[model samples]
Target: MSFRWVAGRIALAMLLAAGAQSTQAADFVDSAQRRVMLPERIGRVMPAGPTAEVLVFALAPDKLIGWTRPLSAAQQRFLPAKAAHLPVIGRLSGPYPTAGLDALRRLRPDVIVDAGPISAERSGFADAIQRQSGIPYIFVDDSIERMPLILRSLGTVLGVGDRAEDLAIYAEHAIDALRGRLLIRPPNERPKVYYGRRPDGLETALPGSPANEEIDEGGVINVAAGLGRDGRIAITPAQLRAWDPNIIIAEDRPFYDSLLHDPIWRTLDAVRYKRVYLAPSLPFGWIDDPPGVNRLIGLYWLSTVFYPDMTQEDLRTQVKEFYDKFYGDKLTDAQVESLMRYAEAKAGETRRVGGEPLVGIGAALPTPVPGPGGVGTGPAPNTGLGGLGLGPPGRRVPTGGMVPLAPPTPLH
Candidate 1:
């Protein structure tokens, strides 16, 4: 039976209860950084970040009041329905725009959830908005290691700690269980893999990032390992030849044509092996954008791709359980397979070829595994570079795929 059948009944029940008590719960939106816990029935949730909006939809669709509309074409078509209804508050941090703080205040939402790092670096804005607007603002961290803690924090403030904890515990175990079942085949048998971002480049996660970690955990070697864990560095075609990976994954679809025409790329091992993969995008934004609790699903996608023979439903269930237990929604059977189906045809067909899939990298950086003052992706935001062996504190992944732990910025 479809999981949606069960989810429908749950949503229907919550929908009715939400209509009645939305006002009371709505106050959480006004508390401004104050911790709040909503009743089991989440009512009027106003997620502030794009990635957070998508996840909040997955978590409690009925409770959300709406979210800012998507800025990109990728999001408008494939993103969640609830997004359309939510009014855009513009950028949450910095200066508010359009409605800015004023409209957000008028909305009188219950909770303002943002995955962006706001407490340490962005806190001044958070504090100002909360104090000036009369709203409670809460920040959710996306550090894989801190997921459980963040989940509990979300639950505590959302008034669903019991349910949140219950699900979080389950999220941890289920991820472990799925990982356990994906047996590691010999390196010889495993296909050579590559994760390439668009604009015709291989910009991807550094080894310490969550996606790389996910790949490693799934027992697959990242073909780009030579690039080092620092992240997607610009590479020449000659460099790719040296790597000679069997699989090439196009992180974004926009660059497919350029990859097909590249003289070096056309003759690459991954091309010959027909291991070009295209990832699924709908709840748009790279799987890692604002990488939050939803990232567990990325691990699930990798397990099935690397070990298709060993894992039948191992990967599928990860999505189901994630949507079911947490989002209370079930993707249709077709939707489930659709998510990973494009992975094999990544570079797409120059004529004939197959596809492939998000490696999790930092999903577990307890501290800067790469550096000294090692700050794990904990809730605490570390902005200093020398101390943390990371980029300037407050600066994480910027316009590029992943930011390198470069030498700290120079002082004036």
Candidate 2:
């Protein structure tokens, strides 16, 4: 109801990395990837992704304008309870970008902080728009290696360099803590791991992807190495069999039942050995998607899996700190466990068929959709060359016909 009420609650949100009082602080932020530390305390902020939202919420709750809608059951479970009072900036799939020009003008936010830049709109100049609109724009990469740069950049823009520097130090220490436990070994000795990318089991990202980098950091051998270093690749059920990896990290297989009922997938050794692992959906995507600032949690989750003998006590505490700091919410022990389960990429027995990698960058790499950050519009799914026919969020596709983007939407 009152700004003060929201302020009292979110002053502790660590995920947002925001820090300000009332609305007095107003400064433009320019994050053109040339990140550096500075001394500015950004009063108002807009979240481009869940990670950015979390960052702002952690540091400055009263300052955050809005968050993306559909905050997932697990992610929402830990919200500050006051978030329900906030508006839905936009939905992830259904709505196009919700950072409205009018809203920015009305709110007159000092800066736009975007952490999720997909290949779709990587160079689309959302930053330039902020400049044109008399606001500063900032971009943070999804890689852990670059997060310190992002934090420092955000620090300078927000006049919270001390807090930002603390965060950078904390993040580095946290990552080092996990890497310290990893048992790096000969390539042959490392456990083979294959990661399924999304709702469908077939699509996967290769070794060079930031997704695989996190896995590689944990001392696990990615089975998808054969797929190449160019990031995600689609392969057949037969090719999967040929790989016959030691461990299968199955992703959000929305259609898990078919794998069991269908006779085709039974031949895989992973299914026979029952070494498959599963990662949580919804909230897990928060960690998995774009591998953002929140991905420190994902790194911890992997550490536990790769080194089953190690207890994740400290990591669990860190999760609590993060939830408290960013969302102003808390998770019961059980909820944290449940949230991490889906993040686990376990072994599964799935055989193969061969075809081109189902993953293709549509000719409309950054297809013009209509909405807050969109450029233009057309009828549903204006199928240009190599279009994925992504008509709308929940649009149903006739079975056996053409499935729109059988692969997972690009997380980057």
Query: Which candidate has the top score in lDDT?
Result: 2
List, residue by residue over 218-290, the lDDT tens digit for candidate 1.
5344555433443345555555666566656676765555566666577787666565666655454324644
Q: Which candidate is the best by TM-score?
A: 2
Q: Write the per-residue lDDT of candidate 2 for residues 1-412, one digit (tens) a residue.
A: 5442243223223223442222244322223322222224456777766667766665567778877665655555666667745776752221266556676677666666665423335425654465467665555543554455456545545656567666666566556656666533222333455676656567776543555556645555455543344356676666666666545666665534434446776776655655566654434343356456666666666665555555446656867676654445677888777765534433222223222121111111212224347434322332221101111111111000011222323333
> Model 2 scores what on Cα lDDT?
0.50
TM-score of each: 0.63, 0.65
- Each model's C-alpha lDDT? 0.49, 0.50
